[model samples]
Target: MSHSSTIARRTTPGRLRHCRTRSERGAATAEYAVTIVAACGLGGILVTLLKSDVMLNALKHLINYALKLAGVEGLEL
Candidate 1:
């Protein structure tokens, strides 16, 4: 056999040794992606709940201001 052919045969198995089948690898990437999405969704829900309280307070202040401008009485503060 030629020197180049023998070298090529020796290198073929080494190249294949570093490769992995899809099923043999663990599912760490998929698990991480799922955890991240769930955390983001939970955060979004918490922010939505908190935003309602802030919006309600702002509306109450606006209403109070309007009532005062109209010279209404009996509005406490």
Candidate 2:
């Protein structure tokens, strides 16, 4: 019984080593990381596009306010 237990322990380490040496484990992690990065990049692009219109409108308002403070009237261009 003791001999069988020792053999089992030795075989377990060998199996673990073999699994770690396989390429599939690292490949899967690499693929997942690439996919996450691509998704984040795409999301950032979309958010920027969506925010730009709002930002432009706000800037226009601020410029108009500054012009009013400077005593500039409309249609003076």
Candidate 3:
């Protein structure tokens, strides 16, 4: 009901709003951590697959074909 009380109420809400905006930075950090873990998991799976003999043979054939097209003799992989 008083002038100072009214001013305090107005300023209190602004302070709370400012505090809310800072929390988004913490949320972004958490999201980045989760994303990195997921990406690492995906990369691990891909590396495992690529290291398999079948995937390596497939890639080797692809490279040999490309080299043949470029007039180089096919490579022994």
Candidate 4:
């Protein structure tokens, strides 16, 4: 057979479909890995921010306001 015929046989419609499916088998795994990494990064950032004095103070102030609204006073969270 000629070289061109050999190449043509490898790229027929059925062969193309099988090749495409095999190549894409890891796509979902790659997507899940990326999502997990992104979630971890976001969690780290949130932990850092929540541990900061500003966020802590804001949270305390909100708690104090809520307590005052509930008829409790002079309590510091």
Please name the candidate that would achieve the greatest lDDT relative to the true structure. 4
Per-residue lDDT over 1-77 for candidate 1, one digit per residue giving the tens place of the 0 to 100 score: 99999889877987879778788576778889999999999999988875897876877788888998899867943
lDDT of 3 by residue, 1-77 (tens): 99999888878866876665654878978999999999999999999999999999999999888888888873655
Model 2 C-alpha lDDT per residue in residues 1-77, reported as the tens digit of each score: 69999888878866876665555768878999999999999999987975897876876788888888899879221
Instruction: Give each model's whole-structure lDDT.
Output: 0.84, 0.80, 0.87, 0.92
lDDT of model 3 at position 2: 100
- Estimate TM-scores for all models: 0.40, 0.41, 0.67, 0.67
Off by over 4 Å in 1: 1-21, 24-26, 54-77
For model 4, residues 1-77, the per-residue Cα lDDT tens digits are: 99999999888999776664677889989999999999999999999999999999999999999999999978878
What's the lDDT for residue 4 in model 2? Answer: 93
The 10-residue segment with the lowest total lDDT in model 3: 14-23
In the predicted model 3, the residue pairs found to clash are none
